[model samples]
Target: MKSNFFRGAVALGALALIPATTAALADGEASSYKALDEFMDVFQKVRSDYVEKVDDEKLIKGAIDGMLASLDPHSSFLDARDFQNLRTQTEGSYGGLGLSVTQEDGAVKVIAPTQDTPAWRAGIKAGDYITHLDGQLIYGGTLDEAVDKMRGAPGTQIKLTIVRPGRDKPIDLTLTREIIQLKPVKWEVKNGIGVINIVSFSANTGADVRQAIRSIDKSLGRKPTGYILDLRSNPGGLLDEAVSVSDTFLERGEIVSQRGRNKGDVERYYAKPGDDARGLPVIVLVDAGSASASEIVAGALQDQHRALVMGERSFGKGSVQTMLPLSNTTALKLTTARYYTPSGRSVQEGGIEPDVRVPQLSDPDYKNRPKFRESDLRRHLINEIKTDNAALEEDSKDDPRFAATAEELKKKGIEDFQLDYALKTIARLAAKPGGAVAQAAPVRKPATH
Candidate 1:
């Protein structure tokens, strides 16, 4: 899932809305009195008759947590301190080490350091577990608490002791906090290919991506023969941005659809008329970290056959959240609907499988093992049963064509294997007898950083 490091405070403020209502209804009629009486009765019973003693504050918080947890993982309840952190993140400035850290197997591990931040400059890589922060042991602390300790004012220095997978001993390093302005989208031209790295889908992401593509076109004198969209480690962003990005690539077709409990929940997004790259071959890269909006774009493109999805299966997150406002600058983010690809496939527990599966190349010993085969995956959820009289579609797992494709990918090595395969596939498509260039579109120049 996309890390909410930047929007942590906003989410917290949103959560505070829930309790405000409890106070407003404090002097309600007989119905309200009865409801409160019943609630207290249950609370007393649980406290006395239950197996264990529960702290009042912790019990209340646990109840709130349980309520939010049932909706979706992304929708969370945040306390006042967590709300402040979320605010700091959305403002695009923070005092701490400038690295995204998460709890993994009881230890705090560095996910990725924001580009140009102190953590990135200090050479902290992904998968490094933080053992200590400022001499305080961090092995047992919650990820949120650890983050609170790390964040501070500019010029303040914090020390971190880290343990990497391949390292023998933990390494200690001191870092100074700075104002971190996250540039969510970055682009460049490498070997005649336009490569765009989307770190997160922030508010300005759609514009950033458009400008990046335009800049690459201007620098190259024409659009590149192929484009590589790197969504690795990107936890998703705003839903509209995902739709906008897909719209840029597709000339027409449904991009994504949403279905809620009621008819009002059903909504479909379609692509615009103009094609941004004018038929350029596109390759989207995804991994376990890619979720939500990332999955939307990948699923849409793959379903429409507009791009070749080359990477591991994405982090499955196909739910929609709506933030409801409360009186005291707080809100409640609730899961209102589930989303699906144009092909009507829901990517909930089962994520969007790539057109071509490519394993990670870091391990040499497992290099020869087949990463994923057609038979390995479960049936596509949407295609399993028909609601009305629609024809029953056969599962991709049972199709010979899908099996052959998996076999083809297994023969290729994982180290840059997906990119190599995509390049060859594009070359073959361009060389086809009836294939024709779309148009000679004007190039767009990029602005220097």
Candidate 2:
């Protein structure tokens, strides 16, 4: 009798929900149709009464772009060329000028040239503003159009007009495009301590890292007592590579977890039972520019008490993006979900805080530089919890800790003070009783192939 009553109750509840659910669906359909009608009305008006004639394809694509741009800074509708470029980014090679840029204040600004590429080899510095490509004025044009102009077939030459800070006149350069191959992992045995610099994450980053560690260990002839991981200014890439790279350091346990809009969209990635370092005291370096995959590695190691995270706070981008292909050789790079550290903390607006806050005194513009964070982006998600961090504009005055300018530092042979300090600290830790890192190995260029 009890079973019958429970079944009857469930049936009645189902019957009661049907009408309300149907009504809600009808309301949703109506609202959607109304929005579609409004869109068409505006589209017709623009087609018939615009100041200048516009192509149908251009208008439609522009509409799609504007719609996606309204969502978030990361979400965008990619054209055919953009799709190809993204594929090149993940595959780790392409025929282009080898540059990374961002649109800021209606201008395309250089983020950083890919390491060891034509741009980097040609001495293209970050923070430079590009004014023209091939003598074409690009300020009023779209950034993608300018980028498309910059990249081309191998051995093809292109000219760039650049406006750099601290320069009196615009600089022009004629560069030949080449096949850019990114070497994601670089290692050095510095002062008896092993140091790894992860420049970017790509398809083969994990395998490369494993090989690098093996090579360093073999050259060391013994396990190093200390290791330093440098990830400063790394813009980040490939989520799978991030997981695999984190796994390279960790023996076991959760590396990262991701959750989408739905409650059932939670997924976790765990590390295997092996670590390349063999339980060495590791220190990770980060700054405000470190983001995405780099942040993942830093946050995971920090939460697991595996490494001491130093330098400034991260760039605070914890969202995952999936490149979904569309018709016409186009794609949609959508922000699919939010990622969390093992400690159940979201790094959306509030990025991973370091175990030790070590400012980059070597960055001469640290004080006056305008730092852009996720919070500054339009339509960025909010953090679920509060965070404590250094002030965005601490002070423009010169820091007493670092009195030397770039030229002065070059004279002193201090190329990177942050790396120098971390290496020394690790050396000190290793020097303690019964502990010392391996002797320094000869610095050699890492092989990308």
Candidate 3:
């Protein structure tokens, strides 16, 4: 029988959505037994002759960890506790500080903080390096270990020391743990337009979005002529949720597809016959922090000419991880396939490029901010094909509108240039004399992952 497939689940730090599959065993060679003999010999020696007696479970778990570690960063062995934690995150609530992070350059790097959570409210930002936890230096530990250190009972507190770019010295912050209930989709009507902020793709994201749209329509007393789907700094969540979100806007076409190692093991997702958005003018906002399921949505809409994707290139993570349950109550999260857009584009090292690249000029550090992407991941999979680098800067002829600094924009009552730009653009197109929607120029065809 085919193994149970895990669609998507939270990654250790935040939205690490990986696909799951039944593991196929490889044929063993004669030397494989010899290697096992060597491993067993070492295991027995460690159990009997170590400086102090070690727990057999610890030794074995460590062995499994090492084995998975050799495969890739996304492939990991989750103990029973970790297995439970993964399930809790998928359900969209858990007791923790609420941050997504990854291992980078031997330090725990924040991917993005879940909005409204303790960490987000505490000012944790993407690209921040978590160097210490609770006065214990966290360097050199696995991402899972660091995440474990951060998880705690609700109402408890934890201390973290962060090293951020452009900061002269390390900063320390104490955060109280809470049950982070991720609502996933939040919407508000702004100036007769609907603004949807997708926090993550949890199990209920699609349903929540539908409800949000209905609420916005009712509250505004009319259907919105335009919608802005903001996906900035969204790490990602359930893959199925991503599909449903894409389907909400698309009438019919391919949404996404995952190709595994086996020649015949390809999974494709498609949109339903109807579009809930009713073909309204839709704009998608993504950024360097957007990843996985986020990229999937942006790529699908962009390819189908259904939405205009704006902002910087996303956090290029196109690989899918499968959660494999082990015999000993432990589980393995392994990257088993590379996902492609409807047009057969891979978002691995090269992320989804926006149709129009817009710089976040209001932030003073925008130019110098360190970009973290799948390429930055230590063991990220290499694209089976190579693609040109996505646009990383404003086109040489800088737009005067974005040359203003944060202080200047604040003076002009513009707090966020990206959102404001998208809103105005949508409004402009809607107000045109012919009432025609303007689509962004198509992005370059992406090379497969």
Best by lDDT: 3
Which stretches of candidate 2 lie above 4 Å from their native place? 1-17, 51-53, 95-97, 117-129, 134-136, 152-179, 388-408, 433-449
Q: State, as a TM-score between 0 and 1, how close model 2 is to the true structure.
A: 0.84
Q: Candidate 1, after superposition: displacement of residue 338 in Å?
A: 1.1
Tens-digit lDDT track of model 2 for 1-449: 99999999999999999999999999999999999999999899999999998788888998998898888778888887777777777775768887888776578877667766778777676667889888988886788788878878999999999887767789898999998776788898987788888888877888888888887788889787678888876779999999998888887777888989898999999888887887677889987667889889988887777778888777889899988878879889999998988777777777777776666555565554555566656777766676655554354565576565666776777767778778877877766874432211222222320
- Per-model CA lDDT versus the true structure: 0.70, 0.79, 0.84
lDDT of 3 at 127: 92
Poorest lDDT segment (10 consecutive residues) of candidate 1? 371-380
Candidates 1 and 2: which is better by TM-score? Answer: 2
All candidates in order of TM-score, best leading = 3, 2, 1
What does candidate 3's lDDT look like per residue over 10-95, in tens digits? 23323332222112122345568789999999999999899998999989988987787777767888877787777776774778
Best of the two (2, 3) by lDDT: 3
Ten-residue stretch with the least lDDT total in model 2? 440-449
lDDT of 2: 0.79
